[model samples]
Target chain A: MHEFAIARSLVDAAIDVARNAGVSRITRIRCRIGDLQQVDGDLLGDAFSAVCDGTVCEAADLCIERTHMAFDCERCGTTFLVGEWDWSCPGCGESGSHARGGDELELIGIDGELNDGNQSAPKCV
Target chain B: MMEIKVLRNVFEKNDRAAEQNRELFDRRHITCINLLGGAGSGKTAMLESIVPILSQSLRVGVLEGDLATTRDAERIAALNVPVVQLLTNGGCHLNATLVQHGLEALMQHELDLVIIENVGNPICPANFDLGEHLRMSVLSVTEGDDKPQKYPLLFKAVQAVLITKCDLLPFVDFDIERAKADIRRLNPTAAILRTSSQRGIGIEDVADWLRQIVNERQSLVAAP
Candidate 1:
C-alpha cells in the first residue's frame, strides 16, 4: 500500500543519516504529514515497523505529526482549509486548488546512538 | 543518544527524479502526460482511439505501465507507433526511477508527445510523479459518478478527467451531472470530457485537448 512506500522512505532516510554520522543504532524517527495526503497513522506505523525490522532502524519508534493545508482564494483573498472536497471559497464561491507536491510528507529528524569506541576502532585503521 | 534535525520531504528522492525527467522532456520538446485511472477505466481504449489522431500532426509514443503483462504495450505497438512496456512485476504503481528507464528506451524515437499510461489503479498511481506536464485520469460510466468522492486524491491531482464509456449511459444508472459536479468540487479547472472509444464520441475533443498542449510546446520550441 501507499503507507508501505512512505514507511520505506522514512526508514531509508533514517538509515542514511545513521551511516553518514557513524551512528550504530537509530532510536526514533519523526515525520510530519499534510492533511491533504490520505495517510493513515496506524497503517504508517505498522509499515514503518515492518520495514525497519532487521535494519539499523530496527525497534525504532516512529512519531507522526499532522499539519493542515491552507487554500488561498484568488477571488475573496481568503486562505482557508478546504472542507469535504469543496474548493469553493466560502466568501466569494471562488474555487481554489493547489497542486499537490512534496509540501507534505516531511521527515523532521532522527535520534540515534553513536558507535562505541570498540565498534568504531576498526574504522580508525 | 544524539538528536539530529534533518527536515526533508519523504518524497524528495522521487520528486528529484521527476524533475530530472521533466528537464529532459523540456529539452527534447516532448509533451509528456501521466495517464492514470482504475482498472478497466478505458485508458488504453482512449489511447488506441486518439493516438492515430494525434500522430497525424505530431510524433507520438507511449510507455505502458502494468503489474506483470506486456498486453497494453502490445496493443500500443500494434498502432505502429513507438511504444515501451514498463512491467512493475507485482508492484502497485510505477515510480520515477522506473519511468526514467522507460524514457531512455523511448528517447531514441525523438517523439514530440509521450503518454505514460499508468498501471490500472486509481489510488496508488495518484501518489507518484513520473515527470509529466499533465496528469489525466480516466473514469468510465460503469464505475458510477460517486467514485470521485470515494477517491478524492486521484480526482484532486488530475488536470483532466475523461468520463469514458458514454455509449453505455442509456443502459446504466450513471448520472453524468453528478459526476461532473463531484469532479468540479475537487478540481474546478479540470476539463471533464465525455468520451466513448467504442462509438468514437468525444475522441476528437480529447485529441484536441492534447494537441493544444503539444502544439504550444512546439510553438515555444520554434520560438527563438
Candidate 2:
C-alpha cells in the first residue's frame, strides 16, 4: 500500500544523489530503517523493483539495515534495548522509559560509478 | 569506488510538508486537529454532533478524507460550514501533501478551527503526519478494547483518545477499564474521554476543550 510511496521516494532520492555525483548508474543503495517504522522489508523491496523499472536505478540493489528499538530509563538514566515490548527498566524496575531510537528511516549512502565524460572505475559516493 | 553518505530520511519530503502546514496554521492563528479512527469508529458521527456546538462560538471547517466518495462532505455541508472532501482514490492514508491542498481549499474562509478526518484505517494513517495541532483517535466499544495494544502506533501517537459509542458499552463486551489502562500505559499524557454522540454525552466537554484550544491560540496570536 503505502510502501509504494516510500519506495518511490527511495528511488527518487537515489537517482537524485547519483545524478548530483555525476554517476550514470546506481549500483546499490544503503538504507537504515528503524523498528518503529514497521515497514515490511519484502514489500519495500518489491515496491522498489516495481518503481525502479525504466529509471536510472533499474539495476540498482537496495540494502536495508534494520535498527532495533531502544529505550532510556527516565528514573535511572540507563539505556537498554527493548525486549518484547518490555518497558520496565532492568536497573531500577521502574516503568515508563522514554523511547530513544529505532524510528529512523534514512538513506545512509549510495554506491555508483562516476561517468566523467569518460570510462571510470565504480565509486561509492 | 566512491562512497557518498547521504544520511537523508526517506520521509523527508512528507516531514517537510507537515512543517510547512504547521507554519501555515500558526500564521493564520487556526487550530487544526487531525481526527483518526477505524472505518466505523464513529468519526463522522462525533463530528456531526460536535460541529454544531463548535460552530456556535468558533468558525469551523472540515476536510473529509475518503477512498472514493463525497457522501461525508455532503453531510458536513448540510451543516452550512465550509467542508472539503479529499478523495484519495485507493490510497490507504492521506499524506501531508494532500492535507496541504485541503488546507488551501479550507482556508478560503476565515476559520478558527479545522478538523481533518483522516481516511479510516488505524495502521497506515498513524505513520503519516498531516500537520495538525492535535492528533485524536476515536475508538468505538464495538472495535474491542484490545485495539490499543494491537495498534500501538496509533494509540501512542495521539494526544487524545475518544472512546466513542459509549451508549453501547453496557451491551458490548468491551472492557473500558482495561482499554483506559492500556492507553495510559502507552501514552500517559493522552487525555482519554468517553463520548457517545448518539446519546449527546460528553459532547459539551469535547466542544469546550476545542474552544479552549482555539482561545489559547488566538491569545498567543494577539500577544506581542
Candidate 3:
C-alpha cells in the first residue's frame, strides 16, 4: 500500500545523491528489505518504476535484497532467524525475542553515470 | 559506471517528521496515542466506549484518519470531544506529515491526551510513525487467532493490544487464550487485554492504561 510513497522517497533520495556526485543518468537502485515489513517486492518494484518516470533513474532497476528477522537469545546468547511466529531460541529451549537485523528498509546504493560521460567519477555517497 | 553506497533508510523523511511532531507534543505536555487496527477491527467502537470515560477527568481530543468518509470523525464529534478528521484520499495509512497537519487544528484545545486513530490497515499503518507516545492495536475477536502471526510487525511494535469483540467468542470459532498467547509471543512486554466495546467490557482497563501514560507525561512536564 505504501510502496508508492517509499518509491517516491527512494527516487528523491537517489536524485539527491546523484546530484551531489555529478551523476547524470541512473541505471540501478539497490535496496535491502527485511522480512518484518510485510512489503511486496513486486509491488515496490512496479511502484519504483512508476515513480522514477522522467527522473535520472527512469531506467534504473530496483534490486531488493531480502533478510530474515533474527533473534539473539537472551539466555543462550545464540542468534537465529525467527521462523513464522516462533520466538523460541533454536540454541536452547528459552524464549527468544527480536534483537537485530529484522526491520530493515534501506536504500543501499545507486548505480549511475557521470555527466561528462568520459570517465565515470566514482565518488562515495 | 559509479556505484554510490547511500545506505539510507527509505522512511528517513517520515521518521524526521515524526520526531519533530513528537517534540511538539512533548513540549506541550500532551500524551499522544497512535491507534491502529484492520478494517472492522472495532477501533472506532473502542474509541466510542473509551472517550467518555477518559474525558470525565482529562481533556481529551481525537484525530480520525480514514480513507474517505467523515463518519468516524462524526462519531467522535458526537461525544462533544474535540475531534478532527483527516481524509487520506484512498491512502492506506497515515504518515507523520498528515498527522503533523492534523495536529495544527487539534492544538487549539488544551488537551491532556490526543488519540490519532490511524487508517484501518493492519499491514501498512504499522510501518509509519505518527509521533505518538503509545501505540495501541485493536484486534477484534472475529478476526481470528492467526492475525498476530500474520501481522507480527503490528503486534510487535505496539505497547498495548486490545482484543476487541470478546463477547463474540462463543459465537465464533476464535480462541481467546490462543489469541492472547500468540500476541504475547510476538510481544512479550505488551499489555494484552480482552475487550468487548458492545458489551462494555474492559473499557476501563483501556482507560486506565491511557491514564497511566497521560499522568506519566504530565508529571514529567511538571517536574524540575
Candidate 4:
C-alpha cells in the first residue's frame, strides 16, 4: 500500500541524483530503512522495479540496510537497542524508556556510470 | 568523472512543499490541526463532535483524506459546513504535495480552522507531515492497549492523544490508566484525554482543548 508510494518516491529521488550527476544509467541505490517504518523490502523492491519501467533505473539494484529501534532510559540514563518484545532498560532494569532512531527512511547514496564513447553496452531487458 | 556524494533525505521534496503550505497558512492566520490515527479509530467521530460545537462561534472547515469514496466527507456535510475530500485512490498516506493540493480546494470556502483527517494508518502517516500547526493522535479502545508501544512514532509526533470509545470500556478490558502510562512513557509531555463519541463522554473536554489551541495559535499570529 503506502510502501509502494514510498518506493516510487525513492526511485524518483535516485533518478534525480543520477541525472544531476550527468550519469546515463543507474546501477545501484543504497537506502537505509528502519525496522519501525513498516515497509516490506520485497514489496519495495518489486514496486521500485515496476515503477521504474522505461526509466534509467529499470535495472538498478536497490540495496537496503535495515535499522533497529534503540531507546535511552531517562531514569538511569542508559541507552540500549531493543530486540524483539523486550524494551526494558538493561542497565537499571527500568520498564520505561524513551525511543531514539530506528524510524528513518532515507537514501544514503546512488552509484551510476557515465556514458562514454567506448562503453556502448546495450540495455538489459 | 567526479564522484558525487549526496546524502539527501528521501522526503526532502515533500518537506519543502509542507514548508510552503505552512507559510501559506501562517500568512492567512489559520489554526490548522492534523488528525492522525489507524483506520476506524473514530477520527471522523471526533470531528463530528468538535466541529459543530466550534462552528457555533468560529469558522471551521475540514479536509478529508481517504483511500477512496466520499463517505466521511458526506458525513461531515451533514453539519452543513465546508469540507473537501481528497481521495488517494491507492496511496497509503497523504503526502505534503497532495495536502497542498487539498488546501487549495479548502481555501475556496475561506475557513478559519482546518482539520485535516489524514489517511488512517499509524505507521505511514507518521512519516509525512501534512503542514499543520498541530498534530493530534487518535486511538480507540478496540485497537488494543499495546498500540502505543507498537506505534510510538505516531504518538511521539503529536501534541495530544485522544482515546475514543470509552462507552465500550465496561464490556471490554481496556485499562485506561495503563494506556495513559504507556503513552506517557513514550511522550512525557503529551496531553491525554479519554472520549466516547457514542455516549458524549469527554466530548466537551476535547472541544475545550481544541479551543485553547486555536486561541493560542491566533495569539501567536497576532503577537508583535
List TM-score per model, in order: 0.85, 0.88, 0.92, 0.91
TM-score of 4: 0.91
True contacts kept of each: 0.54, 0.54, 0.66, 0.38
**What overall lDDT, based on C-alpha atoms, would model 1 receive against the true structure?**
0.84
Q: Candidate 4 lDDT, tens digit per residue, A41-74?
A: 8898788889888998777777788887778897
Q: What's the C-alpha lDDT at position B109 in model 2? A: 98
Model 1 C-alpha lDDT per residue in residues A1-125, reported as the tens digit of each score: 68899899888877887788888888788888875567888999899889999998895788787776566666677767647655567778765434333237789887777887222111110
Pairs with backbone N, CA or C atoms under 3 Å apart (clashes), candidate 1: none
For each candidate, the alpha-carbon lDDT, in order, equals 0.84, 0.85, 0.86, 0.83
Tens digit of lDDT per residue, candidate 1, span B112-179? 99999999987778888889999999999999877876677778877899999999999999989877
Shift of residue B165 alpha carbon in model 2, Å: 1.8
Q: DockQ for every model, please.
A: 0.34, 0.44, 0.53, 0.37
Rank the models by DockQ, top first.
3, 2, 4, 1
How many pairs of residues in model 2 come into backbone collision? 8
- Give one digit per residue, the lDDT tens place, for model 4 in B80-197: 8889899999777888899898888788876678899999988888888778888899999999888887887888768999999988888887888777876876677888989999
Model 3: residues with Cα > 4 Å off, grouped in runs = A72-79, A82-100, A118-125
TM-score for chain A of every candidate model? 0.78, 0.86, 0.86, 0.85
| Best-matching candidate per lDDT | 3
Mark the 10 consecutive residues where model 3 chain B has the least summed lDDT. Answer: B177-186
